[model samples]
Target: MDHRDMRISDAERERVVAQLNTAVAEGRLTIAEFEDRVDGVLRARTFGEIEPYVTDLPVQQVKPPEESELRSRSSSLKRRGRWTVPRRLTIVTLSSSVKLDFTEAIFGAAVVDVVLDAHSSSVELVLPAGAVADVDSIYTHASTVKSRIEPSGGGVQFRISGEVSTSSVKLRYQRRFWRWRW
Candidate 1:
């Protein structure tokens, strides 16, 4: 698909930068070239603007996500590994399970907001090291909420707020390589 005209998210730019870094490590790009592309990516505002920087370099499908929302109804959904984190998200799970792992997520913004709505469901948040989460607005009724991470300054901050009804929500920090742990 031609996505050059689409507006690019900061997370998308970061993703391309990471790909460039890998290319340099693999000897596919020189240090100077990588530096130049990196600069271009950070300054890019549109998809077209960043295409040239990674056109010749290897990359995954760089299409920007339409929006930032994951919903499940009586089913299971998981997000992990090399996914792009949107600027804002709204996740709703209805009597289902949803796990959002941000350890390897490409952050699109320095500050992100996540709204979670759970109903008789389980929601798990696996955060990246040095990332902090604030749940001051989270409210629950007859539910279990456990967090292993205390609010603190970190590389990327996720401001979370939501309502849970008869469900469980847990938050923790996990190593990027550890996917088995919930």
Candidate 2:
């Protein structure tokens, strides 16, 4: 028997479904195509049956980078709008301001690891809805860390770790209008 004849497990089927979801979110597939492919994946029972649904779709395997760093000495660093959020990010600054807005940013992974190293500066993270952050690993001296959003069990999480000396770090959700929280 060929390897393609092997039976497929639910996990394998769900992986394909996740790829299909990403495809639709990236606009690579229309809603109709995504629905059709998801339906096919649900019915697939063998490797051969699942091969065709994603044969033409591009692979979006999330591979985390070793470490990407952004260093600033006297200027402000801002990352906002539809940008790709690195799996591991290191922000180093001195006497500067840093703001990372993830409202429309693309997440390569469910959790983002941010390492902060600042002196006499301020760092702010503007998270989107349904996202939470963990900042317990950060070490602060003569600084303050504040997060308006409560940490939850699931969804997108930010693992913030590092040191902030004479600096501050804050986490807040994106606001819509002056009174709307959307």
Candidate 3:
């Protein structure tokens, strides 16, 4: 089979997702457009199926932020609007809160691994409709986790592993159940 005809890998799909996220982050795409492309990315089986998503976007030469800065903890943090989504993001807090809304935030990968280090703190992630968040493992120590993450059709994959201590880890999905496209 030709290169484009070969089956794609998870990493490849992620790379494409990252690119699509980047395109949206740079104002080249609207949320609806990105969502549509993400659906195509997740369901894509071959490279030929995903090339169209980023064909019109320019290649970014800027390097992503350093690990130290990206992994830093914050208090009362909220990530909204257009922001770059890293491959792996660790949300940490001592005794505060962090809210990440992916409804408008751009994704950097198809399967973004999100680590919630809710140490005496709380973490809330707001995902778009159809997005799936797979809680790989959750550990609660004097904490509570309210997850609305369930398997859904046609969206990105989020692998979540976290420890909640005297804190809460919540995954929220927005959009009416009756309204869906994909």
Q: What Cα-based lDDT does every candidate model obtain?
A: 0.83, 0.87, 0.75
Q: Which sections of candidate 2 miss by over 4 Å?
A: 1-64, 178-182
RMSD of 3: 8.3
Point to the candidate with the largest lDDT: 2
lDDT of 2 by residue, 1-182 (tens): 99789999664677689899999989989999999989999998899998899999987676546568999898999988667778899999999999988887767788899999999999999987778888899999999999987767555899999999999899999878888743
lDDT by residue (tens digit), candidate 3, 61-108: 544443222233545887786566777887777878777788755565
Indicate which candidate wins on TM-score: 2
Off by over 4 Å in 3: 1-74, 175-182
Pairs of residues clashing in candidate 1 = 11-108
Better of 1 and 2 by TM-score: 2
lDDT of 2 at 62: 60
The residue-by-residue lDDT of candidate 1 on 12-70, one tens digit each, is 67678888988998999999998888998898889999888987976565544545788
Ranking by lDDT: 2, 1, 3
